[model samples]
Target: MAIKPSKGFIYLLIVAVFVFGVPSEAHAEPSYAKYGRAAMQETANRYPDANIIDYKYEGHFETSGARNEERFRLWLRGSGGEFGVRVHVYVAADTGQVRNVELEEIAR
Candidate 1:
């Protein structure tokens, strides 16, 4: 007589493959690093004479019906004084091309 596997045993094998075969970090991407570099460059352009003391990612926001942007707050110190500025970097989600940069000084 030929040996046969039970239905329960087949299901258990399938479950084990699914539980251990998938990579945990498969969805991780380096896109954030690129965005951070762009944000810092934008801040440097806005305040060429200032030194960047610190910065924080403020998350994502939609600027218009068709455009999305990443916001960052950069703390800077220059010859004049120390202050914080909000930098908005608009980039294409698909191509990663920088569309525009906008800066606003936050009240100290």
Candidate 2:
């Protein structure tokens, strides 16, 4: 007997695809090397002649397992007493891209 797919089955299939189709970059990791590069560019773009001297990744890095979310935090510095910015960024380990960025420290 040739069994045909019911309308309900088709609808369920469609819904399943829709629900699990798009993937979030929640499992990605931030590239420690390029993180500084792009951040320097962004800082320069805003500051204009902002001399970035050094940077460091600070805080705890946690990966998603059962009790943590994948995230990393970094701190950046620039010339002329530029130790006023702490860049908190979250990244997805699967995509290796920044998921969120929080720039703390505004020049006064």
Candidate 3:
């Protein structure tokens, strides 16, 4: 006898591909490599002696109706100890100029 595919099996495969193939917003990485670099540069400027071990893009937030900022968390190792810092890279949406950078230490 010849083997044949079931209708249920075919439907399941289609459903699996539809669900798994689509990229979700939460799982997608932002196209903000330049912004991330700018944030890292600012972090380096602030902690000249500290070495950045790792970093991640937390996400972007709207500061105001007209302003939006990209947030990043940087892990650093210094002579004192290992610590994390949050960097807020503010940029103008219209002109794309870096407005300001705010750094805050993350408590362990």
TM-score of every model versus the real structure: 0.65, 0.44, 0.69
lDDT of each: 0.83, 0.56, 0.89
lDDT of 1 by residue, 1-108 (tens): 998999999999999988797756766664555677888888898789999999898888876765779888889999998999988888776676778888899946
Give the lDDT of residue 55 in candidate 1.
Answer: 84
lDDT of 2 by residue, 9-68 (tens): 999999999778966567456536565555555555655645655566554366563222
In model 3, state the lDDT of residue 101: 89
Better of 1 and 2 by lDDT: 1
lDDT of 2 at 3: 97
Ranking under TM-score, best-scoring first? 3, 1, 2
Candidate achieving the largest TM-score: 3
Best by lDDT: 3
List, in order, the clash count of every candidate structure.
0, 8, 0
lDDT of candidate 1 vs native? 0.83
- The C-alpha stretches of model 1 lying farther than 4 A from their native spots are 1-30
